[model samples]
Structure formats: structure tokens, C-alpha cells
Target: MIDTRWWQRGIFYQVYPRSFQDTDGDGIGDLDGIRRRLDYLAGLGVDAIWVSPIYPSPMADFGYDVADYCGIHPMFGDLEAFDRLVADVHARGLKLVLDFVPNHTSDQHLWFRESRASRDNPKRDWYIWRDPAPDGGPPNNWISNFGGPAWTLDAASGQYYYHAFLKEQPDLNWRNPEVRAAMHDVLRFWMARGVDGFRVDVIWHLMKDADFRDNPPNPGYRPEEGDIGRFLQTHSADQPEVHDIIAELRRVVDEFPDRVLIGEIYLPIDRLVAYYGEDLAGAHLPFNFQLIYASWNAESLAALIEEYEGSLPRGGWPNWVLGNHDRPRIASRVGHDRARAAAVLLLTLRGTPTMYYGDEIGMENVPISPEDVHDPWEKNEPGLGLGRDPERTPMQWDASPNAGFTAGRPWLPVAANFAHCNVAAMLDDPFSILALYRRLIALRRVHPALQTGSYRPVTAHGDVLAYQRELGGESLFVVLNLGGETQRGIALPDGVAEGHVLLSTRLDREEKVTSGFSLRAHEGLVIALSAAT
Candidate 1:
């Protein structure tokens, strides 16, 4: 079978819809806002746009706690607007990947409402509900990911409901065949509407321990790590049955042509790759988030990449991510100078690269004041700096009022440097971070080596990570200087006597190398090596 799936080689750009753009002066981004910016996304060269959840919800955990799986949120737009957005995305030859919230539903969802109505209700089994322990307290020691107890008492029903993150976001009982079919049907609803695929949210948390055992304590956890780390989550997440459910989802997605299923799994590399399933029957792209958590050092990162690459199931492709809605912006994590080099590292690596929206313009995390804070996690757990609000701020399109995101107030404040560090400003500057990203993406599209080639780690000394991507006798060497000091006499492999710089993170420097190359502080370059003589 020829593997020509679009997601396999193409790049992904994730947009947090509520902060993307506002079209109706409603102070919130809508589907039309995204529609208006489709051209911008195309110009950026992303193969698809994975918009965060825009479904009807009570705003408990933003759109993750979905109220209706098939309906668009009124705040975002109606079905008509969504149809137009889908049309526009397709019109530009781009794919649309919706955020599929399968693990939980809003308390306001009809299913949840029916389930919590009464113990004898027909829909009572739709969600995870349990009777209290003999002492009349909560069911178990499982704690909510946000904070406090995971079980919530329902006075009206005389039972307690389980939630992974927020009480208002109840976990669905995937052990029930009915719930699995229902969620699969939801995928059908979107696929029928022309959505190319789905990035399933919190996919590993779909099934829990059938016995409802208490999660064992995590001995490595510290007070500063927040309540979630207090337990190993042995009974609450990554259950064995989740693979069956993921395979079912894969079967549903396979029913449609050229569609992809991406699972948002945060397990160790060994366990994370299991989502690929035997014979490649599971998620087409089990999102690799190791880069997001690994130490930003060359030695450690090189080892991490090797481990991930070494773990893939036969015929399984690789993917990479630098940042996301839940994590701090890349610039904030690695600093501005290193972010440019990081871009080269991300795009030049051997996999599908998922870029966060504001990353192209090098947007950092915006500071959110307590008065303006709105993330439910932060609200649930005070003063832990656990809230995602800082990273979910509005995208800075231009240097206009509200950073050109909206005419009215934005849902969150734009990053402080938006005036000069934005698309408009970067478009005109050849050396800007956005230019580097665009250049790297364009380069990747033209070069088969960087697209789906084999990756081989190259040896280089301290603070420098080197690798080569090769296909059909053509090779691209990526050398990154993760440190601040210039490195001299970096040796090229034998038979690779000469090559010219294809693209450099430094932007100003380009050269033809003979035997060796020197890297400046925090610099990276992609060199096209001459075929071995």
C-alpha cells in the first residue's frame, strides 16, 4: 500500500478559535473570523488548520467540555458560518481538522443532563456515576486534574459523578458500547460536513479502570507540581481499553477517503507509540509531545528524538510539536534567539510538524492579570500558575487597535510586543522569524529528503546537535548551535566534502562549506550536501 496520506508529510497549524479573530464585534473570535483569515493561513504554507473546539459549551473548560457534539457554538457561529469556513478552507486546497472532544461533555449537554436527572433515568449510564463510599464521602482518592476531588456529589440523584478536569466536564463511559457508537457518529457528522479529520482531545483519558480503584500516589511529585501529580493516575487514565476505542475511531475515519485521526496522548515515548495499533490500525498520527517537555538541550533532545524514532511501529510515521494551547509559548520556554533556531530544528526534522498559531511571528506568552484571568484551571486552583490563559491570548495579526484581532475588546490581551512583532511587520523584514518559518516550509515542500526521508543522527560536540535527512542520494544536513558560544571546526562526515547553505536561522549568513563549518551563537543552518564522490 502506497502511503500518501496528506497528514503524513504536510505541516499543521493549530488555531485557538476564540482568540483568532472576531468578525461581528462580539469581542470573541468566530468562524467567520477564521474564514476571513483563510488566505493568511494559506500564505503561511500550512497544509491544514486544526481549530480548537468551537462547539456549544458552558465555557467551563472553554470548548473542551462540549455541550453538543454536532452543533456550532453560538458565540463562534452557526452551522451556516461553519459551512462557509469549511468551503473556504477547501477552496484554498487546505484541509480542516476539528478538535474532537470525545472524553467528556459539558454538564449542560443534553446527554449529561439526562444522565444526571435521576438514578433511574434511561440515560443514567451515559456518564460515569457512582455511589459514595460507606462513610458517605466521595467515591475514591482520585483527584481532578485541575484540583480537589474528582468525584462530585449530585444531591438530586443521590450519586457522585466523575470528571477528569472540571466538575462541569463529566467523563463519558466509553466502556458502554452505546457511548462509543454515539461518539463515532459524531465523527461521521463532521466528516460528512467536509472536515478532513479530527485531532481527538485527551484521547488517552477516554477509558478508566473498570474497578474504579484509587490512583496510586506519585512519589516523585512535589508540592509545587500541583495536585494532578500527587497521584500516578494508574486507575484514571491510559486504560487498556482506550486502544480498542481508538481503533474504532480509526475505522470510522478510514471509512472516509484521505482523512486522518490524530490522538493527543502525553505518555512516555514507549507507551505513546502504542496508539498506532497493530498493523497500523490506530491513530494515523499519535501526536508526539516529547519536544514540549524535554530539556531544551541538544544532547538530551537528540536522545529523545532517537528514542521516539526508535519506538514507532512498523509503517508508522512520525510527527513533532513545539508548543500548544496548554503549554507555554516556545519563545517563552526557549527565549527569542533560540526560538529561531528551534524553528529550523522543528521544520527540518524528519516528521510532520504542528506549529502553534502565533509561533510564526514569534509571539511569546502574554501576561494575564488576576483581574483578567478566565482559564477554569487557574480558577479551580489558585496561585499555582497552572492556568493556560497566558498562552491562549489573541493572535497578533497587525499593529492596529487590539493588535488587529478585533475591533472591540479581545477575549484576552494581546502579547505586549504585538505592535512591532506581528505578521505585517515580519512580512517586510527578510530576517524575521516568520520569514524563516516560511522559508523552511517552502524548502521542505520542494525537497523529498526533508519530506519523508530517513533520519540519521550525526556526531557533533557540545551544545550542537546535528542530523541528516536523506532520500534518493540527496541529503540535507541540519546543524543547530543550542549554546551561546561560537563553535569552530565542526567536522563533516567523510565523502561529504562540500555543500552550500540552503537556509540559515541567522538569515544574514550563507556559505559553501568544504570540509568543516563554524556555527555562531544560537544559530542553525540546513545545508544541502553534495552527493558522495
Candidate 2:
């Protein structure tokens, strides 16, 4: 095996900058605030942090709409603050990964402004613009992933610009050579500033169908699946040409030694693996989102893991994410009890795992009233159960007001249970979720089998999901009870007659086991098996 890269063996903590910590009393988290929290993150044992977008933006899509690719947002900080933050992050012996929004730019961006100035402008081709159909309507039946028509009429030019998301964020024409060159330079600008890597956003949407064909109607569509799911998105996303773009992007990143590229893709296991590129040249790790949307059950999750493992390209690394800025917190989805077990499951799996900012403390989604909702999707399509505000609440650092995330009022309200679930409350409690996460992270670091070993699923009836990770004569067995009630006498895999329980999600004392092992409801544990001579 190629020597394992730091990113491959390390745990990734994703910090949504807006909600991580606020230092300027502006009700928003900034670079300075993040710099102040480096000690806390290091204490948590995470190897690196993948920060969400902090670049200059109009906040149209909450910083996804980049108005300036090479500059920090005023709300976050200036170049000096960002440079200091990077230096501090490296000083802590942790890597920093910035969110790179490559598919589009804010309508207010200089390039977009020039593109929209006139039909004959030199940068007119920088964005996707087309003349209206004969009926004076949109060019096709394509709809934005956010809601409504994908094409927004530009009255000044008598044309319509297409957006995969909000109209304020127009999709860039990656087909244009100039646009590709400009975006590549954005990478170089940050690389020179000492960034460790980037998590490219919406990478699959970089190349839409050249003919602008209408997406097909979804046969599995349901009223509750949101407007974006009303169609299959076959033509508008996952076009084959997108691979070439990814290959070129990878080439640019390779110029910087020890730097990596991560792509955020929500495609199927087979298609998602393609982003790794032929010869493993695309994304170093295409964010695996199977656990994010999979059914919360043992059978389903086991099948999903097997499918993903079977689909990986030769020499391709794997990664897992349970929660992120765009999704509901894992504690909210699977209940606080099961989230502990999920944490063990996530970290023990044979791959790199990413933890959302507040998940280590068992943070759940806070309810957001209609007036408090800030997500563009919820505003555009009301009552679709699509608002992300609940999951984007400020980090609950302590019991203080606003969860100690800000000196002033936070951009989003802290969870009501913050007092009990805050980091301070869990810091010393051995049974707390935060403690469980730290233990799991530490175990992963010390155990080579848990880091780069091969995964072999063991047959376990009922709600028990069991697997073994073996490497260099070291074998670790992980078993999880995903059910709501106690499960007894779970048969250990044959030939694993005796072992020592190294750690348990409950943070209880280790025990020696033989043949059969019983598990409490929502319990998970790792047992170290004796190596065969």
C-alpha cells in the first residue's frame, strides 16, 4: 500500500464558520473567533478542519454565492486576519481545508457584472446565458435546485441566465476556457497563502448538458421530497464531461505537495466513485454521503457500506460524513441515544470520517420560527421541511447566553438544551457524547487496523451491525446495537472466541469476552482480537 496520507488516516471536523464562534460581537463567527478556538479543537483530537465558505459574498446563499474568490468576507475578516488564522491553525499541528465554490459566482461579482452588462461584453460567455425560447419564456423546462425556473430573465440583455440554485448565484460556464483559468488561479491564490486543501462545492454540476435538455420527471417523486426532487436531474447534473474538469483541477492541486482535494458530490455510489478519477487522479476523497440519507437501520447501513466499498476505484481512499451545514444534525435524525452509537460506527469504519462542528457534543437541531428562517431554499419554497437554519445554529460552547458562541446575539439561536449539552457540561463527563467521540478518535489514531485495514462484515441477526478491521496481524471487531431495545447473546464471528473490549460507546470499563456478547439498546463497542501467530 502507498504510505497513508495524513488526510486518509485523520479525522476531519467541519466547522461552519458562521456558527463556529463569534469574536467581533457582530453576531457572526469570524476568522479571529476560529483562531481563538484552536486549542479547543486540538483538545478534541481532530487532525484537520474543513471550514465552510468564508469568502466575500452578498450572503445570498449564506456565503456560497462568492462575490470574490480570493478575498475573505468582511463579515469574517480581511486577508491579514485570514493569514493569521492559517498560521495559527498550522501552529496547532492541524491542517486547514477551505470550502471552494467552483460551479458559480454571485450576481454581484465583477465577472458576472461584466457578463451581464451587455450581450457583446468580453466576459459575456463567463456565465451560462441564452436567448429566451420562441415563446419568450425560459430556454427549457429545467428548474433550479432551490426552487422555481432555473433561467432568470436578464432584461438588460433580453436573455436569461441559468442557475442551478438561486438566481442571485449564476452558474459559471465551465465550457469557457477563460473561466477555467480564472477559477484555477483562485486555487493558486490560497495555496500561496498556505492552505492545506479545499472541499470543492457542487463539483458534479460544473458541466451541465451542452444542449440544455430538460430534466426528466422523477417517477419516485413525492410531495414531501421538495421541488428539486420533482425531476431526475439526469441532464442538468452528472454529465460525463465533468470528469475532465475534475482531472484538470486535480492537476493544479498536485503542484502543491501534501495538499489534497475533496469533492462534495451526492451521486450514487458507482457514480460518486468516478470522481476519484482514472488512476486516482480526480478528488483525493469524494465526500461519501451514504450515511447522511440512508435509512437509520442495521441492514440498510450494512448494505450501503458494502456497496460503497465494492464500488471504490483501485487505490481510491474513502470518507464518511454523518452531518454537515446542509443537513440535519445526526442527533436530531437518529435521537440522542443512537447518535452515540453512530459516533462509534462512524469513527470505527475503515475510512476517514468527518464530524460536524457540534456533533461531538450531541448538538441537535434547534427549531427556527418562520421569521427566524434564513435559508434561501425555505424562503423560496415555504413549508417543504427544507430549512437548514435549525441545523446551522451556533456552537454550544458553554452554558452562557448564546451558548458562548458570541458576545452579542448569535445569527441563529442556540439550542434550548445548550445548558445541558454544551461543551463545558460534557468536558469532564466520561459518559458524555463528547467524551465518546474523543475516545473513538484517540482509538483510531493508535490502532492501525482501524485506520487503514480491510473491512469484513460479520453476520449478525436483528439490529446488530458487526464488522472486523484487520491490518498487519492486528484485528479489531466492532459491534453496534442499532435497535431501541436490548439485544442479547450476539454471536461473535467464528474463530474470534476470545477478545478484550477496548472501548465502548457507553464509556464503561473494558471487559473480556468469549463466543457470545450481549449489548444494551443503542450500545456499541470495539473489541481487540488476538493476532494469529
Candidate 3:
């Protein structure tokens, strides 16, 4: 029998702190706001809440740029507020995971300030710094994820510093022993504070090529893909040495019981699986984001899922992410109807599923006007539609002004459809997407087949994707229609003559299936299969 940890058998909900709620009337979500919503989160049926960063910073990249790794940002809350939120979350039997950003820090950080203060500063090696090229240009051709060169020349120091993102956020030198020790202490500090786990940001970028070689240009790069894609990033990220660093970090997390370390990696399936490390010693859950980028069709998704599952290392667990703060919402990527079907696919997959806040209500991306844009990526590289502000808009809780996310003006504009697409509005409607999510989650919790069962692909035709999850004699069948046209006469897997509908995306179906069933356009169904004779 396989030992299933809480994170492995449970659903994770990502809460974007700046947008989840606002309690101080500051137009920004704070720790207190999250505390006030603990009951709502517990009722949502998620086993864990993975909140985005709330560390002190200058908002260079929102909360991703950390100035103080051990403290909470005043904008979000103080130590008291964070401690209270953690306690409240635990009291409700829910785990809380914080975003751990060890790769970079805000330029305003004391460490960075001390490093750049002078060449003789003890902390000069804390961040990645190098002498400028002979031409007084950047050290190399590496490009920042935001845009342009990754290196920024500091006049006072007469040396270039590397930043994988904006200039305001400088990448840390993980190669330095002191840097590693300090970062490990940061993890210890949080773990001591009762943090259940950490979702490490940009985990793959922790180690860079020691040679500082220039990355080769991509011949297939397209103008529409933005400047960051101009190169293949061969040297800037995903170094083999990263696995060792991850293993070290894993040791720190292991010191605490039942703690998890989820790495945010966006590599190909082959490279992504390597983060699990030999003998499964790396991150507990290197987040699988292929679902977010894969083509949203049955054939494409089927192939992608099969490849991902096959690529996992022995004893390595898998997880799925449909949307995140950095990506477009599901409803916007796929239409609202298809988003419902996608939700079923996400929860029913043979791995842990992470639900982004507001996705339960089918929140679509809101348009961000030029004046309203706050994302540094959009400001640095405009017209590529790479801005994340659209997806990070304030959550919609009700029909009240500003969608009840705040009494004051929201930090970002609320979605235009918030009045109709909100938690409160959907709570009253049994057929709402919110209701469907609740039922699906409830079903997943009660069924062992949906938790740690073996996955087998069922023979599916055309736009229908079919699969089975079975643990012992208990079995569940999942079928989804990924197309816009209704499918009829779909074949069922062998040994499964009929099943009772447990839940449907439409939230209007509950009957026994004895023959080929018809699925509505953009629909999904979870069925409890009868015992095989």
C-alpha cells in the first residue's frame, strides 16, 4: 500500500493575497482579510491554502520581490496578523502554504543595499555581481524574464548585477555558502512559525550556469512571443546543480513533520520531472503546469496527460495547476461553458489539483487599461498581452460595490461581470459553477478511488476523453466533452456496463447509465461505476 500524505491526497487552493479580500479599507487584501474568510475557505472543501507571497517589499514584482524574508509586509499585515491567520487556518483543519522566493530579493533589501554599498562589503557576494564586459556592456547576453538584458550596471560599484526579472529585483547567488545558509534559515524561521509548507517561486532558476555563458538565440522565436523568448535560456535556468540545492532545501522542510515543498517549474515534461530528484528526495510536489499551457482539446490533452504521467520518477507524486496568478484564468482561456468542463478534468485528474481563487465562480480575465496597469512585465514589454494584471484582479464576493472585495477602491479594477459572477450570487443558484465545484470536491473527498487510486485510460472517441480511477473494487469513471458539439453513443470501458452519475458540470444530471450516453457540448461527468462481474 502506498503512503499518501496530506498534500498528496488533498486539493490546494492558491490565494492571491493582494486580491483575495480587504479588511482595513486600504483597497488591498491583508492577513486580517484572509482571517475573516477562513470559514468560507474551510467550507470550500480545499484541504490546503497556498497563499502567494506577503513578504515585505517595495512591490517591485508585487510580493515576489522580498525585502525581508522573515517578516510580513505592512501592506498585508504584521507578525501578529500573520500568526493569527495561521492559527485560524489550522483551527479549521486546513493547511497553510506560503510562497517562498529564494531566487531573488528587492533591490531595496538590506542585503542588496549592503552588497552594493562598496566592493569591500561582507555581503558583496550575497547577490550575483560581475564585472562589466570589455565593452562596458552587460556581463552576458542573458535576458530578463520581464525584457531586455538581465544585468544592470551599478555606477557606484562599477559592476553589473544579474536579475532574472526586473532591475529592482536582483537574483541571489545560491552558489555562495553564506547565501544558502541564510536562505535555509529563512525556511527554518517560517517552519518554526507553523507554516505547513512552502511553494518555492521559480525553483528551477535557483542555480545558473557557473560560467556565465551567453545563451544561444532561438531560431524559432516569434515576434509575438515577446523578448524573453528570443533565446532558449540554455544557461540562465534549469541547471543540473539545482537538484542538489533542492535536496538541501528538502532537508530543512523534513525537519518539520508533514511539511511539503512545492516547486513552481515551467519546464518541459522531461526536464520538469527531474526536480523530483533521484530516489524522490527533491521537492515534494514540483507543480505540474502543463495543463495550463497545453492545447485544450481532447486529443492534445489526452496525449499530454499520458506523457506527464509516464515521465514521473519512481515513487514521485504528481500535481496539476489549471491557472495561477501569473497565467490567464480558465474561463478566459476557454469559454465559460468549457471552463466548467475543464474544472471537472482538473479535479478528476490522477494527481493533486490546485484551484486558483475566483476560478470556482468562473471568473474571466478583466481588461486592464493603460493607466490601470501595474504589472512590471507589462510596463517593460507592452503590446504582447503578457501582463498578469488581468488575471490578478480583485476577487468577486458579492454584488456590492467593488464586488465586496473592498469598501475602498480596489488596488486593481474588479471584473466587470462580478455582479453576476460572484460567490454570493452562485451560492443561491444550485446550477452555478460554484455549486458544481462544491459537489465535485465533496465527491472527491468521500471516494478513495478519486484520492489515491490507479489511473487507466479508457478508449475514447472523437472529442470525448474517458478515463477510470480504481482503488481495490471501488471504481470511478470520468468522461469529458472537450468540444463545442454534443457527443452521442460514446463507448464505455470494458467491464463497465453502467454507472450512476455522481456529479456533472451542468449540475443538473443524476441518473444511471446503462448504454451509450450523450454528453452535452462542453460538459463533463463523474460516474460511480458498478462492480465488474
Candidate 4:
């Protein structure tokens, strides 16, 4: 048997620090607040915690524009507070993964500041800087992910610097050997501080075309798709050279034993899988986000899973994500009932699963008014509905003022449904979404078939999707009804006559099942199948 690492078999919970818990009553969460919640996370059965950026920043992109890679932001905490948090997390036996934004740096960063100070500055080559086009416009036709041109004109230096996201985030020049060495040292600095892993931010955007070619216009782009989709991004992102850079990053991570490298690549599955590098020397997991964007019907999801599984390179591991800080909550995307069913799908999948901060309680996207909007994406491109503030609201912890996320007002407004849709409220209700997630995770813990077994598709028809996980003769069958109509006499694989119900999304009806069983609307089940007889 192959030796499985801790990341391979463990569940990862993403903690968005600013909205998780606030200790100083400043309407923002901090490191000590996360330390206080370690017990809660341990009780939730997650084996790892992946915290979003808490690094020193100008808040231009809300931590994505990192000003200092090695220091913690004062708003979050100092190095001492971070050390204490790391200690507490390790004490609870949970691995800590930090977000590593290698693609860009805050314009205020010393490197960028010097690079923009003058054309002759020593660090002028640290970031991508190019002369203006013949027409004195942007250097190329590349579009920023946030909005507008990807290049920002620096009047002082008489050059334009490139940024994939916000203008305040200047893209690093990975082609420079010094820049690559400096970034690798950043990883070593954190690994020495005991960070178990890194979820590399936009790993695909690390390198760009050397000639700075203009990307082709996206003919199929629609107005609702927002400004970033206007171009095909053929030259600006997903360059072939990125794999070599990733392999180098992988070497840095491999220096520290048992540390995993997860890449954030938003390309198609075929392109996304390439991040694994030759012989799986790239990212350990490239963050499978198909569930977040795929249609929620059984047929589409079934095909997606099969395609994703088949697309993996030899020995490459798979992972799944349902929601995250940048996407809508599962409950809001698929409705509350189907969200419960989705939880079962996530935990029972063949690889590591990442649960967003408030997803366990079936949190929906909160409405963010213009006055309360904090996300730069929304502020920069108003009324296009591209803002992520709705999905990045404070965690609903209790029924108290501010939902117990903070004593002061939250940075983003708490969801109005938090009064009844909180951890405290759902913990007592066995049928609640929180309870369903807990049961699913607990079921994964005791069943190796559910944790590291092979995934075989049984059938996906109408509203019912069925599959089986088997390892060492232990077979666990999962059936999910993705619609509002009840499914009757769902077909099972040949010779599978009866099985005992191990868990259900509705938290009801446990008994031996045979050929004829009625599945409730928006329900899912995990069954321990009997031997073929």
C-alpha cells in the first residue's frame, strides 16, 4: 500500500480571517480570534485549516496586494500573535496552510516602490515595466481581472507596469532570477515558522509571454460576464513557462517534510491538471472548483466528476471545492436543501475537500448595499454584480448582536438570516445543515472507503446520482436526489440487493434497504452495501 500523507486524507477548512472572529472589536477578525476558535474547528472534524491572506498590506485588494511577504498585517496581528496562533493550531493537531500570493505585490511594497522610483533604479526590473504603446495607451490589450487595463501608467518613471488584478498590485517579474530567488526565500521563511502548506494564489499567472503580445478579443463574451472576460487571456496567463516555475516552487516546499503545495488555477480541467507538472512535481492539488461553477443537476455533475477523475495524470491526487471567499455560498447557489445534498457530495468525494468558513451552517450570500460595499471589484465596476462582498460576510456564530463575530460592527454586514441560521441555532437541530456536515465528516473518518478509496460511477439518471467507493472489500454506496421531486426505486448496480443506511442528509430514516426504496426530495444517503449474493 502506498503511504498517504496527512493532506491526502484530511479535510481542509478555509478561514477568511477578517470575517472569522474579531478580538479587538475593530469590526475585523484577528489572529487571537482564530486561536480562540481552534477548539471549535477541532470539534468540527477538519484535519487542516487554510487561512486566507493576513500579510502586511495596504488593503488595496484586501490582503491580496501583499506589501510585506514575511510580516503579518498590524490589523490582524504582529509576529508574536501569529506564532501563538500557530502554536495553538499545532497543539490541536491540525495542519496550518497559508495563502501565498506570488503573482504580484502591493504597489507600496519596497520592491515596487524602488522599481517605480526611476528608470535607473536597481530594482527597476523587479516588476513588469514596459514603454507605452505607439498610441500612448496601455502596453497591450490585456485586461485586468478586476477591471480596466492590466497596465498602469507610472508618470514618474515614464513606463507602464502590469497587474492582473488591481492597479495597486504590480505583477512580479518571475523571468528575473533575483525575483524568483526572493520569492522562494519567502516560502522558506514561512516553512521555518512551521506553516504546513501554502495555497499559492493565481499560480498560473506567475509568468507571461516574453514579447507582451495582445490577447485576442473574446467573441462570446457577454455583458453579464463582466469586464475581465472581454479578452481571451491567451498571452497574459497560463503560459507554458509557469510549469517550470511551479516545479521550482515545489522543490522549495519539498525542502520541508510533509508540506503540501496547492495551486489556485481557474483554467479548464485539462489545463488545470497541467499544474501537477511532469511526474506530479508541481502542485499537490490544483484546487478543483468544478463544483462551484458546474450546473447543479445530477447529469452534469456526474459527467464532470467522471471527466475530472479520468483527466488526472498518473499518481496525481484530486480535490474538490464547493464554495470559497470569491464565489457564492453553496446554499445560495443551489438552494438550502440541495446544499445539504452537496455537503454529502463534497465529503464523500475521492480526494481532499475544502469547506468554506460559513458553509457548514448553510449560509447564503448576504446583500451588500452600495454604502457598505468593501470589495474593490464591486467598487471599481459598479452595478455589474461582480462584487464578492456578498459571499465574504462575517461568519454567523450565534444569535447575538453581530452574530458573535465581533462586539463592534462587522467589516461586512452579517447575513440577516443569522438570527436563526447560526452555529448555536443549528447545533441543536439534528436536521440542520451544520448537523448534516458534521455527520458526513464523521462518517468519512471511520470509513476508509470514503476517505481514500477508488470512485466508480454506478449510474446517474433523472434526478438521482449514484456511485460507489470501495477499498479492501469495504464498499460504501452514495445516492443523491438533486431535484425537488421524490425519486422511487432508484436503480442500483447488479448484485447489490440490500445495504444498511449509515447516514442521510435529512437526518432521518435509518433501516435496511433493498431494491425498492423511496428517496426524499433533495436527499442523499451513504449506505454500507452487502456482499454480492
lDDT of 4 by residue, 1-533 (tens): 23688999999999999999998999999999999899989999999999999999999988999999999999999999989989999999999999999999999999998999899998999999999999999989999999889998999778899999999999999999999999999999999999999999999999999999999989999987788999898999999999999999999999989999999989999999999999999999999999999897889999999999999999999999999999989999999899999999999989999999999998999999889998999988899888999999999999999999999978999998889999999889988888888889899889988889999999889889999999987998999999999999876567887899999899986889887788999999999999766
lDDT of 1 by residue, 1-533 (tens): 12567897899999999999898987799999999999999998899999999999989888998999999999999999999999999999999999999999999999999998888888899999999999999999999989899999999878999999899899999988999899889999999999999999999999999999999989899877688999998989999888988999999999999999999998999999999987899999999998888787888999999998999998889999999999999999999999998899889888899999999998998889999999988887779888899999888889998889999988898888889988889999998999999899999888989988889999645899999999887888899999999988876766787888988896887789876679999999889998666
User: Ten consecutive residues with minimal summed lDDT in candidate 2?
Assistant: 524-533
Residue 395 of candidate 1: its Cα lDDT?
A: 86
Give me the displacement of residue 501 in model 3, in angstroms: 1.0
CA deviation > 4 Å runs, candidate 2: 531-533
lDDT of 2 by residue, 1-533 (tens): 33799999898999999999999899999999999999999999999999999999999999999999999999999999999998999998999999999999999999999999999999999999988999999998888988889999999889999999999999999999999999999999999999999999999999999998888899999977678888988999899999999999999998999998999999999899999998998999999999999887888999999999999988888899999999999999999989998999899888899999999999899999888999999999888889899999999999888889998988888899888889999997888989998898889878888989999999545789999998877889999999989888876667666889999889995988877668899999899986433
lDDT of 3 by residue, 264-361 (tens): 99999999999998889999999999989988787888899899999999888888999999999999998899989988988888889999999999
Off by over 4 Å in 4: none
**TM-score against truth, every candidate:** 0.98, 0.98, 0.99, 0.99
C-alpha-based local distance difference test score of model 3:
0.92
* lDDT for residue 359 in candidate 4, whole number 0-100: 94
CA deviation > 4 Å runs, candidate 1: 1-3
**lDDT (Cα, 0-100) at 262 in candidate 2:** 96
Highest-lDDT candidate: 4
Q: How accurate locally is residue 377 in candidate 1, as Cα lDDT from 0 to 100?
A: 82
**Alpha-carbon RMSD, each predicted model:** 1.2, 1.2, 1.0, 0.9
